[model samples]
Target: MSERVADSTIKGFLYQFNKTILEIVNADDEDVITVEGVVEDVDVLSASGELEAIQCKYHETKEKFIPSLIFKPLLQMAEAYDRNPSARIKYTIFIYVPNEDHCQKDIDPSILNSALATTDQSLSKIVSRISGKFDKVEFLKNTRIVFGPSLDEIECSTKAALELLGIQGSDVDTLLYPNSIEKIAKLSSIKDETERQITKAKLYTYLSSATHTAISKWTLALRNRSEILKNIKQQLSSYFSQNSRDRYFYIDKNEIDDYEEKVVVFFGNYIKKYYSKPSHVTAPTFIINDNIEAIRDLEFRLYTKGIKANTGLVGNSFVVDHFFRDPMKKINRNHIEEREFDLRLLAMDSEQEAINHRKGDDLYLVCSNTPNNIELTDVNFYQVGISSFNELEYVIGIRNSHE
Candidate 1:
């Protein structure tokens, strides 16, 4: 038996981190804007050529306002103002901490007042105390700090944003952040349920330990703004496809061609041996099961090859269960044939017509990695294909182990 790892505290923090971003994007009096830069944690570019840069900090255990924590963001804001002389760019230090008392009473007012300070001496003294940097009252005037949105505020803003953006889903926890959604989409490409669960678990464990510090230190290096913006736009554009029918069990596109190659090699040889193939016959193309559209194409090819393949789940659930429990145990010469006969006798026919097409003496093909070997009496009525994902893993494992 294997020991399961404990979930980390940072998982909750990541959730809160995204919610904070959503809140900032749809802040009151601000139209939802395209994030324009990679310099700040959250950069909102308004239509009127104004910029609102927001730095998000989530410290749940900290009781007091940390001065040193605000320094880098403040310095960045000062530099940003210098870079863009014409644009009315503003900076906001958005803090989300568990200690609401100090934030609500002291930090909020102090930040606003310091930003509006008329005298250079007062602003410089405050800046020197916090960041060891001084001068530039004009830059300080455009900067502000405030406590981040509360849970309730986040909830309200999320609902409004979803509606405004025409997104429909009952999942409350799904943040409207582009990077988060992209991560989910990437994970969806893993076809095996067990692999997906294990991979996500490892990812969460890694994220919990390392992601927070990395995110805080992100501004140390800046990526190309256009490329970052393009990626973000592309991800946001794919929101409609986030609920794709086979998203959870789809094969990754990168593996699709290789899977087709393997299928051609494996099944083409089977066809040549079992059924006579003319010299004029070309290599049969395979459609991955994960592709709903390509599955139809596969059926057409199979039909042309004098083999009709049915992948529907009408009467498959029972057979699937039977296979998992007793794949090698043959109750009858034709298990599917016996079941169909019983169903017809009882007048309990399946609504789906796909399963009725194949009958007795025909080999049942299951796409799974189970029952390493199978045997049946007279004509050997069973056949199963190793899942493409597992086959790929096996091939890779063998090659690596050989070296």
Candidate 2:
């Protein structure tokens, strides 16, 4: 497993490093923004009318080297600039070696220079390849590469810059600050409630039209009793023939009726001991009744859990009317026969949380709300709610049994 550390620690280091570099470049006029997390090695962007990309690597040893690292990021930077011709970007690669003593003893300075020269050549080759294939207006130009000075030199330069800016050591210390444990504690507290709200929204949307289909199936099954019984008998016969005992004791119909009575009594006793009152009805009777109750009960449970019913509001209305309605209508058709049902619920909010209540799949965050106000029907329930995006604590309650 990879070593785990606080994200704030990483961010704090990057902030200080960026602060130090901006001072060294004397690019005070340029905007310095810390681009967090996404890119592999790149840390900060210094851009005025032109753009410069910087990659920071903090390594204790050679084993920490991330291979062929600069090639792709350089290509991406070049492409980013090409897309926006008006805003050109100049690329700079900074490899910070804080522990200078660990630097390979036999490695020649000239060879290091040659490797950088080769990387520069490779970057130009990449730009040429892209330009040849596509009609993009911007191609990389005026790109520069710099190897940061020794750690002592970097620290001295940074301290000098701090002094020049009239920043005290305490001020520098403040910039490297990490998030408090209390802040994390507060976030953890709300995380569960947020997850529950998200789950409720998801269940509401899924159960909206699909609940009708499940009810309709039960109703149809009751109406066509002969056909349904025939299918059930065939299924049960197949199951029992493979699993039941081969030897059969001869018994009269009266004895068979008596055995069934005792079996029912035993089942009732078992139910009374362990199961809830609603779950204790006769087996075949409960199967039909439970299907109807499940649909109604699910809606009630969702409401009680804090999800609102479909009120035909514009934001939440589209998903219920368009996406779920059609699929549910088809579910009533004759040929639809499946053991499991899969449904998607679009959250009432514009954000559109997607809550997927599958039999065994881990509940996960699939998508975030995008800027485009497009009507989304197939979104998971968790994506739409007010609380779901915060953190995934309540997802534990939304298991197969709960669904």
Index of the highest-lDDT prediction: 1
**How badly does each model clash, as a count of residue pairs?**
0, 12
Please list the C-alpha lDDT of all candidates, in the order they appear.
Answer: 0.37, 0.30
For 1-403, candidate 2 gives per-residue lDDT tens digits of 3333443344334433443334333544444432231221333334435445554444323343332444554455555545554554545555544433333122223432333345466565655544334322223233333545543455455445433443233222112111111111222234343321112123223323221011111111122323322332332233223311121111111212233333233223322332212222111101001122232343344355433222212442343333322122222344333212122223323223211111111112112222233322443122211122111111211111211
Model 1, span 1-403: residue lDDT tens? 2221111233233434444345443554434332223445455555576767776565555676666555555655655566664567777777665655424222343453444342556455544443324336665667777776544454455446544543343222322332332233333344543332222233333333321111010111112222333332333333212222110011232333356555434443433432222221221112232343455454455556555343332452424222112112213443321111110110112222222322223222333221222222332121122234333222212122211
Q: Cα deviation of 62 in candidate 2 (Å)?
A: 2.0
Residue-pair clashes, model 2? 12
